[model samples]
Target: MGIVRLIDRQGNRHELQALEGWRVMEILRDWGMFVPPRCGGSGQCGMCHVKVAEDWSGKVLPPGELEAKVLPLLPGRGETSRLSCQILWSETLDGLTVALP
Candidate 1:
């Protein structure tokens, strides 16, 4: 188990219990957060966008090929933008922080 910190659009912070092997999108969705159903965790749709905290950007691996292509076209993409569906939760990701765009 691990903790993942999430910041809503309104800047409210939330701490979630993250299970290993689950996708970040799944964690958010299961916690009642608004994750779009576009690609349904397939990493094809960019709707599950998140801006990784600058300090945490290097912690998570780079986006996959499909996520790489889609992220660039997203509206609020930042230098640390990522597709949540492409991120698999794990012990190493404990304390990871991301903000919804």
Candidate 2:
């Protein structure tokens, strides 16, 4: 398992315990964060957008083809923008930090 820290739009910080191989969105939703998995983690909806913290951005897995197609369409997308539903938890991301965009 790993720790995933999230900052909401209002600047509220939340930390969640995430299991390996689980999607980031799954962990966030399980913790009752405000992430809207409108597409049920299928990467069809852009509601699960989150920006990886700069320090850990480089460590995050690269976006897949589906995410690449959807992320740019969302408002406020940045270099660190990612679809949480598509991010798998891993030891390398133990202290990962992300913020709702």
Candidate 3:
């Protein structure tokens, strides 16, 4: 299991273990985090957007067609903008931080 920290909009931090093969959004939603997993996390909606910290932002990302479409619609589109629903857990991301904007 990998532990990932999610800093919510109000700056509250919640630590959770990323279930194997589960997207960050799903983990958050399962843990009762505020992320809206609308569009079934298909990347059709930008509801699952999360901001990766400077360090983790540069890491390799999960790829998908819907992920590409949703990234541009997020609040702060950046080189690291990602739909949480698109990200899959891996060992390298155990201590990753994601800020919910």
Q: Distance from true position, residue 33, model 1, in Å?
A: 1.0
Q: Rank by TM-score, descending?
A: 1, 2, 3
User: Lowest lDDT 10-mer window, candidate 3?
Assistant: 60-69
Q: Using Cα atoms with residue i matched to residue i, what is each candidate's TM-score against the true structure?
A: 0.96, 0.94, 0.86
Deviating ranges (above 4 Å) for candidate 3: none
lDDT of 3 by residue, 1-101 (tens): 88989898899988998867787888888888864766887778888888887889767475577677667767777767788878777887888898887
What TM-score does model 1 achieve against the real structure? Answer: 0.96
lDDT of 2 by residue, 1-101 (tens): 77999999999898899999999999999988975687999999989999999998889879999999999899999999999998899998998999998
Q: How many clashes in each candidate? A: 0, 0, 0
> What's the distance in Å from true for residue 67, model 2?
0.7
Q: Report the Cα lDDT for residue 93, model 3.
A: 81
- Name the lDDT value of residue 44 in candidate 2: 91
Distance from true position, residue 65, model 2, in Å? 1.0
- Comparing 2 and 3 by TM-score, which wins? 2
